[model samples]
Target: MLVIGIGFFYLRPIIPFLQSQRAEATTVNKVKAIETLQNSDEFSKKLAAAALKRTAEDVEYDPGYYDIAYPGGDLPANKGVSTDLIVRSYRALGVDLQQLVHEDMSEHFRLYPQLWERKGPDRNIDHRRVPNLQRYFSRFGKVLNNSHSLDDYDIGDVVTWSLPYGAAEQAGSHIGIIVPGPGARSGEKWVVHNIGSGPKWEDKLFDYEIAGHFRFGPIRESMTAAADTKSGATLSN
Candidate 1:
């Protein structure tokens, strides 16, 4: 009788906590589309839009890894400064992306790989092998899947991926964010991810590259103060 009573006492408090966590996982709330961009301090919004534009919509399949090219005829930076682009954009947004600490972006992935266990129709990533994926997922709220639904995902929305890396492209590694466009059919939802690199969201995941995707919406301007991100030399988004 004592053992049973003790077990009940120990678990009583935990049941409520576990229930709360589950509740948090299932909830889905997406931010508005262009409104998110327009409100996200012009610079951050411009950078988010630019990262998507900088993707493959360019000169046509150059067939090279890390091919250096600028978007919309914009001149390319001397070095591939992807991180710089993100931070500068944050500065423009009146927030510092660098200020986002690990805690700010770490605990979002509660269940981690479990979110997208199998290689669903996407055929992109394993969802588990993605870099720092657990951190991002656990730190943020419930992640959004790839399927399009304007009310479900929006601009400045962040996504993470467990990508396939290494020479033969057989290895698994990579993580990034997603930027949404007008509508689901508007065809402008792009990604802001990094595979074996710093914080820069890429436009597309081509070749045999497959990684986890986290549909993280941009929070209010005041949230950046919680981000304890690391600083680095100037880089491009």
Candidate 2:
């Protein structure tokens, strides 16, 4: 009885320490799991790099309607919106989101939101809308859980947020692509978006209500074929 009491008294102080160690281990395991599920594959790395490259461009925040070419269409390089940033990034990977979204909406018109009350798909402006892009990603890409936890996000992941009503020109919804955090925030992840000024890499991942999170890698077979064609080579069976 005396020995038991002595051991209990001596071990009491370290109990909290042991509990903290267990908690830390649990956190590490969770981080590992997130990393595994959202593993930074070659496609993701290239996409993230493409997104990072947008930070160097001088683009104006413009959402005006323009009749651009079909398939490989794009607005002027100097003008774009948030979705434009995403579109341009994917284009860098030889994936034309404008054409993909337009084609998908044409086939699955009912699957998209009718907020705009459009009679049919408008390829010119459909892919540039945040809701359309959200639906497209949900349908074709991997939709991830939305949470305030920073660990839930990773490079190349796409995040959508609900802005306050009448907040700014981008009042309804906003989207951004996750990129590696900048200098001081090196350990954290940042988002590349054009809120108003232009394409920017900022630490605003959890600034608003997270609506959707997505990870989209280009279709491998198509991307490979596109690359081979660009390099003046043909794929062999």
lDDT of 2 by residue, 79-174 (tens): 888999998888877888877888889999989998787989987889889999999999889999998888888778999988898653446689
Per-residue lDDT value at 162 in model 2: 89
After superposing candidate 1, which stretches have Cα over 4 Å from the reference? 1-47, 50-91, 102-130, 146-153, 167-172, 180-186, 192-211, 215-237
What's the true lDDT of residue 130 in model 2? Answer: 92
Name the regions of candidate 2 deviating beyond 4 angstroms.
Answer: 1-41, 168-170, 220-237
CA lDDT scores, all candidates in order: 0.38, 0.76
Number of clashes recorded per candidate: 43, 0
lDDT of 1 by residue, 15-126 (tens): 9877554333111202233345556664435546544433322222111123211111111332223333333334444444333322333343343334444323111122
